[model samples]
Each structure stands twice: as structure tokens, then as C-alpha cells.
Target: MSLTQRSSGLVQRKTATVQSVGADGGVEERDDEGYTPDEEEDHDSKETRLTLMEEILLLGLKDREGYTSFWNDCISSGLRGCILIELALRGRLELEKAGMRRRSLLNRKVLLKSSNPTGDVLLDETLKHIKETEPPETVQSWIEYLSGETWNPHKQKYQLRNVRERLAKNLVEKGLCTSEKQNFLLFDMATRPLTDGGIKQKLFEKVQESVLSRWTNNPQKMDKRMLSLIYLAHASDVLENAFAPLSYDDYEVAMKRVQELLGLEFDAESLKEGANELMWAVIAAFSK
Candidate 1:
């Protein structure tokens, strides 16, 4: 089947059932369509256009709560890693040859060859940061610096400020999430909830299928973008969120498959390739 047909089927299957208390204190069943007309239109526009950063943020976000899970502390850094990978894929950044001594990523350096605007605000800012730093730093150091993991707490400044909020706003712009204010009796909190369940469901299925079936035996055959998602999601500890509905045995198998991928090491020849370098760099960041 075509992707559109498959997505439509998934959306139809995911239509939510609403239950309400009737006047007689009994429950009444109400069938509600999952998305509004505008939302449906938006979904068609955004169905296949999500960026790696956007996908990661979506996976990390809680559906109704409109925020990320507490256990996903690594997401900030993971997203930064995603930025690096994206840039590398676009030929904006590369590892310095002289620094690749096979010792450690800490000793290696990431050089910015082109500052040509990526038209992405976050990516452009990250590129500018890399270009402006006096002495170049290694991929590992840059990941931690962008993640806000640093000494001299007062001077550290690479946290990708307002990362969650910015990404949430971006999702809102894409019509995947709705910005709503909720009252907690004392103050109001602004939250972004998944208003387009179809899109999110599709993403979840993609990740689950890749990890559980498609790439389990041969991860090298997975799409580069999907591979990046798996590594980043696992690094952020949000892979469980994607597999939450699976049976115990399925989940266990998926975890084992992921461990297998994580355990695989890249040889020197593979690391010389641009794509492999970025992939290994991300893996190395999370491995630590």
C-alpha cells in the first residue's frame, strides 16, 4: 500500500472513543473523530516532512500533559547531537582529520567548513557557535557543551536555551500540537498537546517496526534518518515510550536488538566516511 493509504488506515483505527457520565450517573459512549478538519489538512501537509529534531521532541513529549517525561534528562543533549548529525549530512560540518588519532573523541575536533545559512534558526546558531569558538573542540566536547554539561558552571553556555519550549512552539506551528492554557488552582500553565494523533502514531509505528523487525538482524540496512532516530531516542531513554504498548516478550526482544546495535563498533575505514563519522559520533556520545 502507498504511505498515504497506510496513514489513513492508521488514523481511522486510532480514532478515540470518548466516555462520559450521563445525567443518570451511568456512562455513555461517544465516538469522536480523532482530528478536526484543519488538523486533517495540516496532517496531510506535515505527514512526511518532520525533521529529526522535531521527531525526537515529539517522542519525548507527553501526549496529554504537553511536556516531556521526567526521566528523559538526556533529550537536551540528544537533540544537540541530532543537530550535529543533520549539519554533517548537509555538508556543513566535519571532523578534523588531524584530530582522528583513534584515541578518543575528546582529542578529536569538529570543524565548520561552511556557514551558509541552513535556514533553520537553531542549526544556524549552532554553526555560528562552532565557527566562533577560538580553539576548536572535539565532537564529544561539543556534544556535552551543547548539552550544557560543563565545568565552571558560571561560564558554561551551550544549553540550547529554551529547547523544549522552542520545539513545542515549532510543533504548534506545524499543527501537530495545540497550545492550551490549563489552570492548577493557583496559576495557569501553557502546554502543547498532541492534536494530531495520526502523525504521532505513524512515527511510533515506524520506530517500533525498525527496532523490532526491520533492523533487528541488519541495522546497517536501516535508513540513515531512522538509524539516527533510534540512536537518539535510545540515548534519551524515550525508546520505552514508543514500545510501551508492546507485549512483554516483544519489548524484551526489542531491547535486546537495540543493545546489539549499540554494541556494534565502527572500524577505522567506516569512520572515514562522512555519514558513518556522524553516526559513530552520535553513538559515541550516548555510549559515554
Candidate 2:
């Protein structure tokens, strides 16, 4: 039989019921509906939902000291499930299932929001980019490992083995990678040879100069312009403090170091203006 049919048969078998009656007069055989009369009666009597009072009582049960066995019993009896579903429907619950267990909800708030289709599209594109642009060496190695000879009854006769098989399998099974994988990728990228402290310094300088041009071109409100200057000045102060303490006489030397890292070609007046701009921008960004 096909997998679908097999799955359906398993479901039917699992959900199936049989009934029998003892001499004392209990149910013996299930009716045509697959459930014994008693089973149906029990199902009908089962509480599938929670009442408002029960919800209030459950909330009360959660104390600073922690819940008791009685409260746990009530939760295990299925009241919590109904209450959780109700909260979810009411946009008051943030559902995060971690391996079938729930996390704490300390200082939590629930707000209703629609899923962002744009974000989903962007995320898919980003993932594709990562896959495409990942070091060619890594991809080639993974492919070679996959196509290597291996045994498999269900898949190709010639199978390679490597981490991608497990990774792809996990992606298909779990839907997506966890946050840990993202962090790992970031660390890996950071360790690549192309990026260094000097590169970061140059990039920051480029971004800062670009922003300065925008600040100069756009005539913003007085308050906005001042705020922007203050922010940049604060950032400069932070950078200065982080560097080795230098004498007031060494200010020129420190400024030269900054220019070197930024890859700036300095004339006389322009060099002075850029230094002032960098210092103010840093101070504005970092200082309170």
C-alpha cells in the first residue's frame, strides 16, 4: 500500500475501540461507530473547555512560592490546555513549544499581530543568498562527501556522506534551523581572512563620511541637526576613551592614527575639518 494509505490505516487502528460486557452488565462490544456506548458517554462527559472561574482559579494557584500538587493535578486534568487555547484565541498567549514543554512567562505580555509576508520573503531570499555565497571550498567538499559511495535501500545506490545530508534532513524535518545555527554562521564568517579590525575601522569611517555628507546636504530642523551632531560627538568620545590614554600633546598623533585607519588622504584645512567631524560624531554617538 502507499504511504498515505498506510498512515490512514495506522490512524484507524490507533483510534479504534472494542467493547465487551462482563456478567455484571458492562459494555461488551463496540457499536458500528467504533466506540463503545460507555466510551462515547465518557467522551461526551469529558470537559473539552475551561470556564472563566477555572481560569481565575488557575491564575490564583500560581503564587510566589510556586504551585502545589493540587494545582498541578487540576492542570494535568486538561483545564490548562483549554485555558491556553482560549488565551491564544484572545491574543493573550505567546505560544512557544520547546520539545512539548512550556517556558516561563515572567513579565510577559501578549499582543495580536499578523505574520509579515514581506519578512518571510526576505528571509527566504537571505537564506538562499547564504547558501549560494557560502565559501565555494565548503560547498565543494560537502558535495564530494555526498556523492561518495554509500549504502542505502531507499535512495540512490551510490551515496556520499557528509554533514549536509544531516543538515538537509534536519531542515526538511524541523522546518528551519534554530538561532544557534545563525550564531554559528556569524562566528564562522567573522573568522574569515577578509575581515579584520582595520577593515571594520575603514568601513565605519566610510559610513560616517557618507552620513556626514547627508547631514550637510539635507537641511534638517535645528533640533534634528543638533541632535545628530551631539550623537556623533558622543560616539567619538567613546572611541577615544577606549584607546590607550594619551597626553593632551599626543592629540595630533591620535588623530593621525584615526586618519590612517580610515584611509583618509588629508590636505591641510580639509584634514582639520574631517578630524573635527569625526570627533564630534563619535562624541555624539557615545556620550550621554
Candidate 3:
């Protein structure tokens, strides 16, 4: 395929060897991303690394334990949020037309801008649902539907089953995680634990630096992928772990900044001439 087709993202995406970190904190030549060449200047693809869903899942998983908290109910919907944002970032989806100034972000419908495959099964699965829907569902509605939290039996078919496990398998394929079986007293189940400490460390540091040293007071100026990471992390109820290792003062400061982001007027941001309305819509849905 030509470079143009490759850069179009999602549809024409195919994984290629790329960069990651080594044990020595030096540039480790590795592999990732079927979406775009890292050197390419495309704005959307430029900020992508492990896809928003993968990064958030990585953050939530315990390195030694190899699973997330059983009591936490938020990550389910949070992963759905990640899927929506991931689709938007890949240029395969967008919020419907904003004809009226009075429409709330939550009420805005999500629609397919393209029907092509995103080279990733989960994304393509969700895309297929969106494409086959009648009038299209609102962002808030889509989140519930995808999470299997909806009451409508027909819409229940829209749910993506075993999302966390499926994403874990993707991580296993990437070599960042190792699949193993663990007993939980009731029964033995398969788990994917971090096999590479370096990769998770680098991801942790990136999340740390986003709010610590490299913080752009303006979300628009921040790397869109990282910005999405912060919000998704929060929605997943795992943002605390990212800040847990910080100094007391730094923790307080980081959380204060996070609150600022949480309180943002998503509608105002969505109304911008070229804003990512789908992203803002997902954020708005999670905020409630």
C-alpha cells in the first residue's frame, strides 16, 4: 500500500516495528501501531502509541497480581469510553452534525464517517454495530449499550463481550504481558501479567510527567492521546494508582489539576470549529 493509504488510519492500518524503551532508560527499538508511521506528520496518528484502551488497561492491571480490582465497577464503562475515543482518534468515527447551538454534548449522536475495518478486531466490532444501527445512538447511550448495561434486549446485542480479556490477549500478543493461569479460591482462571517491567515503567512515567513536569495547562495544547489517557484513567477508577507513588505535595497538586480537567465545560470545547466532538462527548458522559 502507498504511504497515503497507510496514513489514512484504522482501515488500512497494519502493524509495523517501532520504538519503545529499553531497560537502561534508553531508546529501545521495538514494535507497535498498525495505525500510522510514527515519523508521519498526521495529527491524529502522531499522538497514538498503544491505543487509548490498551494504555488505560495497562495502567489498571497490577504487575504482580495480573488483574484489576474486583470491586471496582467503573472500569467496564471506562473501557467503553476508551473504545469510543479510540475510534474517534483513528478517524473512523465522529459525532453527528451540530446544527443547533442548544444541543447538549450527551445528546449528540455518534455516527460512522467510514465503514472500513480498523485493523483491530475490537474497534471493527464496535464500528460494525454503529454502522448497522438505524438513527444512531447518542454518546451516552452508546456507552451504556457497549457495556451491556442497557435495558433494551435488542440493543443488548451491541455489547462487546469479554472486552477486558480480549484486550489482555492483545497485550499478550504485543509481548508486554505474559499469559498465565492463577487460582482465585473459587476456580482457576487465565491471567495476563506484566512480563516487561520497563514498558510499564515508561508508561507510568509518561502518565506522571503529563501532570507533573510536562503539564500543559491547556488540554488543547497537550498531546491528545495523553489527554485522553488521563480522563480514561480517571473514569476507570485507576487514576489514583498513577499518582499514588508521588510525594504528598505532588499528589495533592496533581489531583487539583485533575479536578480542573474534570470540571471543564465539554460543551464549550465541543462547539469549537474543529474540535473533536466525539471525544468531548465521551468525556461528558463519564463526567456524569
Candidate 4:
């Protein structure tokens, strides 16, 4: 299945590659099947796409409550991890080379491959922070920095504020959710509840398909984005939300398969050509 098809609900976008960063700092699209001048226009006519961060957030959110578990502290870090992988997949971010000494994944620094805007506010904001930072940060550091969990005052500046709220707003804008004011006794805060169950159901179907019908035991063979989603959702401690509705037999089988994926060697996968080392690094960071 195509990348957009796997994640898409109402509309699907054709496969395209980012061949260059235009002078204006936006990505220049080149279709994988070769350039079709109208292809760009065609792709844009489709509905807005959800980023990996949004998908995972949607998975975690309660359809009616419009909020995740109060005790799920891991999600903050997990969402940060998703942002990094999302940026990498969009051809906007990457990891520094291993170099002659062959450095470890965590030891390598995160670099901006292109300053091209992702068109998502949260992504654009994070990209700007990465572009402005003097010394590059490692994947682990970036996660902590973006999560605002770092102790260093200067590093704390890199945090992406209101991440959950922002992602929810993005969903709201796309018509998948609706924002409402919810009171919590002390204060009333904005909450985004799922509006379009059709799209959200599509997300559930894609995730289930990944581990069931489309199960590729080898991480190398799996779609990088989907593979990352499974790991990231698990890391966020919200993966069970997706599988919770499964039958007893399917749930057991699906979880068993995911555990197998988690046990694979990250270092080895990172070495493969075209592999997103930054993604592996995020998985590794979360593992610890």
C-alpha cells in the first residue's frame, strides 16, 4: 500500500519525492514515477494530511473525553519523538553521519537536511528551533528539549509549547475533531473531541492492518513511518488504546507481533541504507 493510502481516510495523495529545497525554503516535489507538471496541483487538491504526531495523539485521545489518560506521562516525550521522525520523513531533518570512528546513533547529532517548511505549525516551529540552534542536538537530547524536561535553562527554550493542544487544533481544523471548553473545577480548558469517526476509524484500520494483514516480520521490510508509529505509540504507553477493542485472540496475536518488532536490533537497522537513523535513535531513546 502507498504511504498516503496507509494513513489516509477520505482522500489519498500519490507518492512523491522531495528532490530539492527551493530557493524559498519550501520542498520541491518530484513524483517518483517522474515529473508530471499537474501532479503537484493534483496532490494539493486532496485534503490535509495528518502527521505521525497527530495520528498517535488521535489514538491516545478518548473519542468523547477528548483527552488522554491523566497518568500517561510518557506521551509528552513520545510526541516529541514523533515530531522528529515526521520531520525526517518530510526531508526536512536527519542525523549527522557516523563518520570514520563509526559513532553510535545517540552520539550522532540531529541536522536539518532542508529548512523547507512542513506547513504544520508545530513542525514549522520545531524546525525553526533546530535551524536556529548553534550546536546540533542528539536525538535523545532533542526529545527531552522538545518535551521541556531538560534542566538546563537554555535548552528549555527549545520546548514546543502546548503540543497536545496544538495537535488537537490541527485535527479540529481538518474537521476530524471539534474544540470545546471543559471545566476541571479549578479552570476550564479547551478540549478537542473526535468529530469525524470515519477518519479516526480509518486510523484504527491502518494500524491493525500493519500488524495483521500486512505483517512484515522484518523491520527493514516494513514501511518506516508505520513501523515508527507502532514503536512510538508503545513508547507513549498508549498503544493498548488501539488494540483494546480487538478480540481476545487478535489482541494476543497483535501484541505478540509488536513485542517481536521491539526486540529487533536498533543499531543494525540504523546502519541500513535509506534507513532513518534518527527514527531508530528515537526508539532507542524511548526504550531507555
lDDT of all the models against the reference? 0.67, 0.25, 0.75, 0.77
lDDT of 4 by residue, 1-288 (tens): 001112335233445554766668976666442333332222233555567788888888888989887888878888999999888876688889999998888899999888977567888899999999878989998988999989999898898888998888888888888989899999998888888887777767777777888888778877777788888988888777777667889787788888887787888889987577888988888775
Instruction: Tell me the TM-score of each prediction against the true structure.
Output: 0.77, 0.15, 0.84, 0.86
lDDT of 2 at 109: 20
Every model's Cα RMSD, please?
14.8, 31.1, 9.7, 5.7
Candidate 4 stretches greater than 4 Å from native: 1-47
Candidate 1: clashing pairs of residues: none
> Which ranking of candidates, highest lDDT first?
4, 3, 1, 2
Task: Show how many residue pairs clash in every candidate, following the order shown.
Answer: 0, 32, 0, 0
Task: Give the candidates in order of TM-score, highest first.
Answer: 4, 3, 1, 2
- Comparing 1 with 3 on TM-score, the higher-scoring candidate is 3
Best by lDDT: 4
Alpha-carbon shift of residue 232 in model 4 (angstroms): 0.6
RMSD of candidate 4 to the true fold? 5.7
Q: Candidate 1 — which residues are off by over 4 angstroms?
A: 1-48, 98-101, 153-157, 184-187, 266-269, 272-275
Worst 10 residues of 2 by lDDT: 1-10
On a 0 to 100 scale, what is the lDDT of residue 137 in model 4?
86
lDDT (Cα, tens digit) per residue for candidate 1, span 113-215:
7888766678888898898886888777778787787785742665578877887898898788999898879988788999988777777777777766565
